[model samples]
Structures are given as C-alpha cells and as structure tokens.
Target: MIRGVRGAITIQENSEKEIIQATDRLLHKMIDENQIMPEYVASVFISVTDDITDAFPAKVLRSLEGWSYVPVMCMKEISVSNALEKCIRVMMHVNTAKSQQEINHVYLEDAVVLRPDLASK
Candidate 1:
C-alpha cells in the first residue's frame, strides 16, 4: 500500500538559514510521527509561498542521511490573496501499510492555521 503524509511550517523570513532549518524541523517531525523510512518514500513534493525565494526546501532532503535516492521536487505555491505567507508545504508519498486515517499530518508554527483539523493538539 501507499500513502501520503502532509506537513507544513512557516518561516519568519525568506532566508536560506531559516528556510532550511524550518524545513528540516517539519520533515523530521513528519517522519517521526509516521515512522517513515527514507527507503519507503516514493517521492516528496515541496511548495513554498511566492515570498520565499532564499532556498529550496528539497535541498534539506539531500542533506538527510539515507535520502540520497529519494526523489524530490520543489515548486512555488499558488498565489492567493490573504493566503498564508512564508509557508512551506510538503506532500510525501511513501509505501506503507497504514490506512489513510491512520496517517498523521503535521502542521507547525503559523502554518498550523492552514490545517487546524490536522494540527496537533
């Protein structure tokens, strides 16, 4: 079976250091919450708000141990008026036996407002 785990985090600024740190935090949380292994990940799709241009979130994956072969892509999130800013979102597809309802989605920082229902209590 295959499933998608979602996560998002908001950074304070469009700086490479902040973006990389926030992305690294969010990805680790998602992986820990879902007990996901790098080998099981099929691919990862990352999107960032238009205001974010300092770094590619996928770059963090490259630095992750054992994630060298994991496929990842990055793109700009659709621009919407009044939408969240400085946010980074990720959708990770992985081979897993867990049901969709069993999967955990992570939302941190200001990005928690983007998915209140899934954000941790």
Candidate 2:
C-alpha cells in the first residue's frame, strides 16, 4: 500500500539560512520518524508562505540531503486571513507498508503550535 506524510513548519524569519535549516530539519525528521526512504517517495510537495520567497524549501531538501532523484515541487501557500506567516508545509507521497495514521507527521519549531496536541506527545 501507499501512504502519505504531511508535515508543516513556520520559519522564524525570512533569512535564507533559517528557512533552509528549518525545512531541512522538518523533512528529515518526518522521513526518519516514519522510516521513509527516498526511493519509495513518489513525490514531495512543498508550499511556502508568500513572504518566504527568499528560498524554495524543496530545493534545499534536494541539495542538502542529496535527494536529487526524488521529485520535489514548490508552490505558494494560500493567502488566508490571519494565517501563519513564513510557513512551509510539505506533503510527501511514498509507497509504504504502513497506514496513514502510522505515518509520523512532523511539526517543528513554532509550527508545533499548529498541532500542539500531537507535538506534546
């Protein structure tokens, strides 16, 4: 069966380094916690807030961790009223033997506030 993992995080600033670092950390955490391999990943979709044009989070993942083969795409996050700023959200689709609930979705840094219930655990 195939399962998908969804992780989201908000950047503390618009700095390129911080954006890259936070995304790198979140993606790695989600993959590691779920035991997901690059080969099994069908695609990874990343969306960043409009203020986050400093860098594409997906590109950071591709270069930082040598995930050149894994399909990665970047998009603009929906602009909603009072929405979190400088946020990056990822949806990773991978072929897995596990169920959706079994997948570990990561929320790091300030993004954890988005899902404090799960983050607490």
**Best-performing candidate as measured by lDDT:** 1
Give per-model TM-scores: 0.97, 0.90
Residue 43 accuracy (lDDT) in model 2: 89
Going through the candidates in the order shown, the clash numbers are 0, 0
lDDT at 56, model 1: 89
* Model 2 ranges off by over 4 Å: 64-66
For residues 1-121, write the lDDT of model 2, one tens digit per residue. 7777888888778988988898888888888898887888898999998899788788777884557899999999889998888889999998998876777778877778778766664
lDDT of 1 by residue, 3-86 (tens): 999999999989999999999999999999999999999999999999999998999998999999999999999999999999
lDDT of 1 at 72: 98
Off by over 4 Å in 1: none
